[model samples]
Target: MNIRPMEYVNRERINRSKQLIFLEPEQKIQDISMRSGFEHPSYFCTVFKRLEGMTPEQFKKSHGFGI
Candidate 1:
């Protein structure tokens, strides 16, 4: 499986986002998004929803985060 550089970066970003969500679930979604290298919170939410099948807030809540 040959992965392009951009694809690898994107994958890493998404993985990082997931880890951050678990690590700091109480943090604001926008903060997490930006920390994960997403330029805009909305874009992050869109991509996250598309890839994870739920919004970041939903994911957090599902994981037992109060947010």
Candidate 2:
């Protein structure tokens, strides 16, 4: 299957978000979202939930981060 441009961008954002979650657990969600190239934290959370099935905070908690 061919991937669309937005799909690639979304995937990259998710990957970067995951990296930030692991590498910088202490970082704020807004900062992580910005670093992942999201213009707004709310939008980032929406996309992340759609892709990952859980919010970033939940993902972090699952990975043993205090959030």
Candidate 3:
């Protein structure tokens, strides 16, 4: 099976996403999107929510950040 470029996982992107999630729990998705190299905040939110099965706020709250 051939994997498409978009479907392939980039470890660096994953790491950046993790850092954005952990280091800036209180920051808005727009700011996180920029810092994480995502040009579109909405697209970022979509991708993030898809990968994690929830919004950023929900993820933070579930991880004990308390919203």
Give per-model CA RMSD.
Answer: 1.6, 0.9, 2.6
lDDT of 3 by residue, 1-67 (tens): 3866664443345458768778877777678777877788787777777776887677778877755
What lDDT is reached at residue 18 by model 3? 65
- Show pairs that collide, candidate 3: none
- For candidate 2, list the clashing residue pairs, or say none: none
lDDT top scorer: 2
**Shift of residue 66 alpha carbon in model 3, Å:** 4.2
Q: Kindly indicate the candidate among 1 and 2 with the higher lDDT.
A: 2
Full candidate order by TM-score, most accurate first:
2, 1, 3
RMSD versus native structure for model 3:
2.6
**Which structure among the candidates has the greatest TM-score?**
2
Off by over 4 Å in 1: 1-7
Over 1-67, each residue of candidate 1 has an lDDT whose tens digit, in order, gives: 4978876776678789999989988789999999999999998888788778999899888988988
User: For every model shown, what is its TM-score relative to the native structure?
Assistant: 0.84, 0.94, 0.70
Model 3 spans with C-alpha error above 4 angstroms:
9-14
